[model samples]
Target chain A: MGNLLRFEWRKLWQQKSLYICFGIGLAINFLALLSAKNFGALDSALGNMCVALNSGYTSFLGIYIALYACQDSSQQTIKNIYARGYSRSLVYWVKYAVSLGVTLATALLYWGFNFLLTCCFGGEVGSFITAVGQALALQLWVIIGYHGLFFGVAMLLNKLGGSIAINLIGVDCVFVVLSLIISLLKIDFNVMYYNLPNLLTDIVEASLMMPEFTSSMVLRGIIIPVLYVVTFVGAGWLVNRRRDV
Target chain B: MNENRQTNYVITTDNLTKVYGKKTVLDHVSMHVAQGDIYGFIGKNGAGKTTLMKLLLGMSQPTEGKIELFGSHQLNLGRAKIGALIEAPAFYQNCTAYENLQRFAILANAKGQDLHALLDFVGLGNVGKKKAGQFSLGMKQRLGIAIAMLGNPELLVLDEPINGLDPEGIKEIRDLLLRLNREQGVTILVSSHLLDELAKITTRYGIINNGRLVEETTATELMQNCQHKLQVLTDQPKQAEKIIKKMYPQVPLLVSESGVEVIAEDIDSGAINRALVLDGVNVRGLTAITDNMEDYFIQRMGGNNG
Candidate 1:
C-alpha cells in the first residue's frame, strides 16, 4: 500500500497539469491581493480571499482528479498497479487519498501565502484569524466532499471529456437546477440548504460575519459533508472493484 | 498437486473460455507453456491472443475454466512472479523512459534493482530526459521490454512485442529475448505475427484460429512430423504411377495433373529413376520437398488465414 501511494504520487507529481493548476490558483490570489491594495480594501480582503480560495481550491482539485482518473482509465495505466499484485480496492483508495492529500497541500500553501501577504500589506488580522481557523476546519470536510464526489464521478465515467464535464458542469449545476426546481414548485426540501457545496458557501459567509463557532455549527459542518463523501465513495468503490481493467 | 508440480509446466489453462455478450472470443483454449521454453502463440488478428494474455495477467476474468500460473491457480500470488506487456506498454507519457521504469520498479518493490542496467539491456541507455510520448513506435517497444524486465521476473508474457520494429529493431529484440531465455532461464510466452522471428526463437508453438487453440507442438516434433514428399514430373505420368506402385507398393503416391507425388519414409531418386526407366517411362523432373514452420502453420490453419 505504501508503494502504491508512492507510485501514484510520482505519477501525479510528474504531470505538467499539476503546475498549471497551482499557477492558476496563485495568479488568482495575486490578482485579488493587487485589487484589494489598489482599492484600499485590505480590511475585508482576507475574508474575501478565503472565499475565493475555497472555490478555487475545490474546483481545481476536482479538475485535477477528473484529469488524473481519465488518463489512468483511458491509457489503462491502472493495470500497472493491479498487475503488481495489488487489489483493485487498494488502488481506488490510494487514488482517493492522494487526491485529498494533494488538494490539502495546495490549499494550505495558497492560504498561507495569501494570509502572510495580507498581513504584510497592512490588512486587519484581529478576530478574523479565529474565524479563518474555524472556516478552515469546516473547509476540510467540504474539501473531502468535493474530492470524493468528483473522484467518484471520474471513476464511474472513466473518460476525459465526460468526467471533466461532469465535475465542472454536472456536479456544479445539477444541485442548483434541482434546488431551483424545488423553489419554483414550492417544495419544502430544507435539506437542500445543507448540501456540501451550498453549505460551503454558507460557512464561508458565516466566517466573514465572524459568527460564534457553536457545537451545533461544527456538527452540521462535519455531518453533511461526511455523508456526501461516504455515499459517493462507497458507490464508486463497489463499481470499480468489480470492473475489468 | 504433486502431479502439477512434477510436470514442470510454467503456465497451463484448462478449458479457458471468454465470452463477450453474445460473441465468444476464446472458446475452450487449453494451452501449456513449460519452464525454460520460449513458447510462440500464433493467431490472426482478433483471434483471442490478447484476450488470453489479459486473462493470464488477471486483467479480466474468464467466463469458464481455469488458468494456472507457476503451478498455482490463484492469480494474485502467481502474477507477482510473472512480468507482462500486453497489447502495448502503458506508461506516463510525460515521464522519461528512465523515470517511468524507476516508478514501475518502485511499484514492483524492486528498490535495489539497477534500472540503468535494464535500460542498457534494451538498447535505450542513451535516451535521457526524453518523454515517452515523443518516442517512435520502435523505441516505445524497446522501452516496454525494459519496463517488463524490472524486478527480474522469472516468467515473461509479452503480446506482439515486435509489432512495429524495423529489421534491425526486430533482430535486437530477438537477441534480447534469446539472451534472457538462455542466460537467466526466464520462461517466455510471446504472441506475434512475425512467424519467421518466432520460428527462430520459440521451442514450442500454439496456433489459435477462431478463438480455439488448434494445434500445439514443439519445434523438433513439428519438424519431424511436417510433411516430406518426393515430386516426380514425367511423360506418361499415369504409366509411371502404375509402374512405381507395382515396384514399391509401400510408398504412398498421389497423382496430380502433370506428375505423381510420392510420400514415403525412405525416398531414393536414383532407384525410382532406374525403376521408371526400366518401365520405359521418361522422368522429366524429380525433387524432394520438406515443409517448414510457415508451411506447417499454413497447412494447420487451412491456408493464408495468418
Candidate 2:
C-alpha cells in the first residue's frame, strides 16, 4: 500500500498539469491583488479570488489530478501494477488518496497565497483570518465532491479525450440542466449536496462573501458531494473490476 | 492437506470463453502451463490468442470460464507475481524509460534493486534516461518486454511480444525469453505468429484459430506428426519427378513445379540421392525439409491450399 501510494504520488507529481494549475492560480491571485492595491478594494478582491480558487477543487484542477492518477491503467501499466501481489481494491484506493491529497494540497496553497495578499494590501488581519477559515471548510467539501465526480469520470471514459469531454461538457450539462430543474420545480429536498455538481455550485456561492451558513446551502454544500463520493467511487470500482483494459 | 494443495502448474484455465455480443471470441478454451515451461501459444490474427491472455491477466472479464494461477485460482493470484504484455505496448509517450519503470515498479509492488536487474534482463540497461516517447517501434517493443519483467514475476504472459521488431529485435527478445526461462525458471506463456521462434524454445504448444484450440501438443509430438520430406531443386523438374517416382514408387511425394518433395517418412537421404544419381536425374540440390509450426497449424485448420 505504501508503495502504491508512493507510485501514485510520483506519477501525479511528474505530470506538467499540476504545476500549470498552480501557476494559473498564482497568476490569477496576483492579478487580483494588483488590481485591489490600485483601486483600494482589497477585502472584496480577496473574497472574489477565494471563490475562484476554490473552484479549482471542483472544476479544472480536479480533472487534471484524477486523469493523471489513472495514467498507469491508461498506459497499460495496469498489468505491471497488479503484478506485485496487492489486491485491486488497494490499487484503486491508493489512486484515490493520491488525487485527493494533491488536490487538497494545491487548493490550500492557492488560497493561502491569495489570503496573504489580502493581508498585505490593507485588509484587517482578524477579518482575513475568519475568511480564510471559511474558505478552508468550503474547500474540504468541494474537493471531496470533485474527487467523487472525477473518479467516476476517469474510470468511465478510460481515455484522455473522453475524460476531458465528460468533465467539461457532460458534467456542466448535467449540472446546468438539473440545477435549472432544481430551481424551477421548487422541490423540497433533504440532501442537496448529495449531488456533486450542485454541491459544488453551492460551495462556490457560499465562499463568495460572508461566512454565514443556511440549512439548504449546508445540505447542498456538504451532504450531496459526500453522497456523490460514495456513489461515484462505488461505480468506478465496478467499472475498474469489470471493464477491459 | 497443505501438501496436496501445492501447484505444479503456473497457469490453469477451465472452460474459458469470451463473447462480445454476437461474436464469440473464445469457445470453452482450457489450457494448462506447467511450472518452469516456456509454453508457446501459436495462432493467426483474430484467433483468440490475445483474448486468453487478457482473461488470465484480469484486464478483461471472461464471459464463461475460470482461471487459476500457481495452483491457486486466478482470483487469488496476487498482481505482483504475474507480469504480462498484451497487444501494443501501452506507454506514456511523454515520459522517459526511467520514469516509466518507476511507475511500473510501484504498481507491481516490486521491491528493492530489481529495477536495474529488470532493465538488464531485457537488454534495456544504460538507456534508462531516453524518453519512451522517442523510442522506435522496436525499441518500444523491447521496453515493453522489459516492463513485463517487473517484480520478477514467476509467470510471464507475452502476447505477440516480438511484434513490429526488426530481425535483431526479434532475436534479442527471443534470446532474452529463453535465458529468463533457463536461468530463473520463469514459466512463460508467449503467444506469437512467428512459428519458427515458437518451435525453437517452446517445450509445449497450443495452436488456436477461429476462436478454438486446434491442438495442444509437445514440440516433439508435433514434429512426429509431420513427414520428413526431401526438397529437391532441379532445372528439369518434370524429368526429375518421373525419375524419382520410378526409383521409389512407395515414397509419398508432394510434387510442385519447381521440384518434387518426397515425404519418405523414414528413409536415408543418401539412399534417395544415390538412386536419383543412378537415374541420371539432374538434382540440383537436396535437403531435409521438416514440418514446422505453421504446417501443423494449417493442417489442423484444414486450410485446403494443398
Candidate 3:
C-alpha cells in the first residue's frame, strides 16, 4: 500500500495536466483581481477571493481530477498496477487518497495565493485572513466532494474527453435540470442548497458577510458533501473491482 | 504431488475458464510451465492467450477452476515473484522511459535497482528524457520489458512482446529473452503469432486453439513429432512397401492411403526409388516430406490435409 501510494504520487506529479490546471486557475484569479476597479478594497478583493477559491478553483480541480483519474485507463496502464499484484480495492483507495490530498493541497495553494494577492494589493489584511480562515474548511469539503464526483465519473467512463466533459458539464446540467423541476413544481424545499456547488456558494457568501451559520446549515454543508464523496467513490471502487482493466 | 515437480513448476492452472456474457473465451485450460523453461503460448487472434495471462496475473478473475503461481494457490503473494507484460506494453505516455520504469519499480518495491542498467539491458540506455508517448512501438516494448525486469522477477510473462519490431528488433528481443532465461533463470510464458521466432527460443510449448489447450509438448518431442519423412508412391503398393521395408530394415516404415512412408532421419529416397523401380514395381513418384512447427500447429488446430 505504501509503495502503491508513492507510485501514484509520483505519477500524479509527473502529469503536465496538473500544472496546467493550476496555472489556468491562478491566471484567471490574477486577471480577475487585476481588472477589478476597486482592486485595493479589502472587502471586494476578499469577496472575489471567496468566489475564486470556491467555484473557479473547484472547477479547475474537477478537470484535473477527471484527467488524473482516467489516465491509467485511457493509456491502458492500470494493468501495470494490477499486474504488480496489488488488489483492485487497494488501487482504488490509494487513488482516492491521492486525489483527496491533491484537492486539499490545491485548495490551500489557491487560498494562499488569494491571501498573498489580497495582502499585496487590497486593504486590511486582518479581515481578509479571517474571512479566508472561516471559509477554508467548508471550501475543502466542497472541492473534495467535487473530486469524488469527478473521479467516479472518470473511473466509470474511463475516457479522457468523456470524463472531463461529464465532470465539467454533465454534472452541472443535471443540477440545473433538477433545480428547474423543483422550481416548476413550486416545492418549498430547496434541495439544490445541499448540492456541492450551492453549498460552496453559501459558504463563501456567509463567510464574506460574517453571518452565523445555523447548526443545521453547518451539518448539511459538511455531511451532504461527505455523503456524496462516500457514495460516488464507493460505487466507483465496487465497479472497478469487478471490471476487467 | 511429488516434491520435485512441485518445486520445479513455476505456473500451473487447472480447468481455468473465462466467460464473457454468452461467449466462453477460455474453456478448461490446464497448463503447466516449469521453472527455467521458456514456455511458448501459441494461439491465433482471439484464442484466449491474453485472457489466460490476465487470469494468471490476477488482472481478471477466473470464472471457474484455479491458478497456482510458483507452486502456491495464494496468487497475489506468489505474483510478487512474477512480472508480466500482457498485450501491448502500457505505460504513462507522458512519462519518460526512465520515469515509467521508476514508477513501476516503485510499485514493485524494487529498491536499489539500477534503472539505467535495466534500460541498457533492454537496449534503451541512451533514450534520456524522451517521453514514452514519443517512443516507437518497438521502443515501448523494450521499456515494457525493462519495467517487467524490476525486482528480478523469477518468471516473466510476455504476450507478443515483439509484435511491432523489425527483423533486427525481433532478433534483439529474442536474444534478450534468451539471455534472461539462460543467465537469470527466469521462466518465461511468451505468446506470439510468429511461430518461427518462438520456435527459435521455446523449450516447451502450449498450443491453444479456440480457447482449448490443443497440445503441450517439449521441444524435443515436438521436433520428433514433426520429423522428416520419405513418401513413396508406386503402382504396386504392397510390393513397394515390402521392397522398401526389406531394403531399409532399420528404418521405420508405415503404409498410408497415399503411399508408403519411410519415417526416419536422413532417409535416402533415391536408393529406395531405384530399389523399387528395379524390382519391377512401377514408381509413380517419390517425394521428401517434412513438417515444421507451422505445419504441426496448423495440424493441431485441425487444419491437417494429410
Q: Which candidate is the best by lDDT?
A: 3
List the lowest-lDDT window of 10 residues for candidate 2 chain B. Answer: B1-10
* Runs off by more than 4 Å, candidate 1: A44-52, A128-133, A180-186, A213-217, B1-3, B247-252, B264-270
Q: List the residue pairs that clash in candidate 3.
A: none
On the 0 to 100 scale, the lDDT of residue B28 in model 3 is 99
Point to the candidate with the largest TM-score: 1
DockQ score for model 3: 0.73
For candidate 1, list the clashing residue pairs, or say none. none
Query: Which candidate number would show the highest DockQ if scored against the true structure?
Result: 3
In every candidate, how many clashes are there? 0, 13, 0
lDDT of 1 by residue, A1-245 (tens): 88889988988888778789888877877777878788987655457546655546666777788888678778777776677767788888898888789877887787777777777788765455676778877887777787888888888888888888888778657777888888899988964666666778877877877655667777888888787788888888988877877
Candidate 3 local lDDT, B206-236, one digit each (tens): 9988899999999999988897888888667
Residue B268 deviation, candidate 2, in Å? 6.8
Q: For residues B1-306, what per-residue lDDT tens digits would candidate 1 score against the true structure?
A: 565677688899999999999999999999989899999998888989999988888788789989888887677777777788887788778789998898899877788999988888888999989999899998888888887888888898899999889999899999989999999999999999888899999999999988999999998888788888889998688998998898779888999878998886477878888999888888888999886777778777667744
Q: Rank the candidates by lDDT, best first.
A: 3, 1, 2
lDDT of 3 by residue, A1-245 (tens): 88999988988888888999999999988776665536543444455556667536876877898888988888888888888888888888899899889888888788778767766775345544555555766677777788888888788777889888888778678888988999999988776866777788888887777645556667877888788878888789889989886
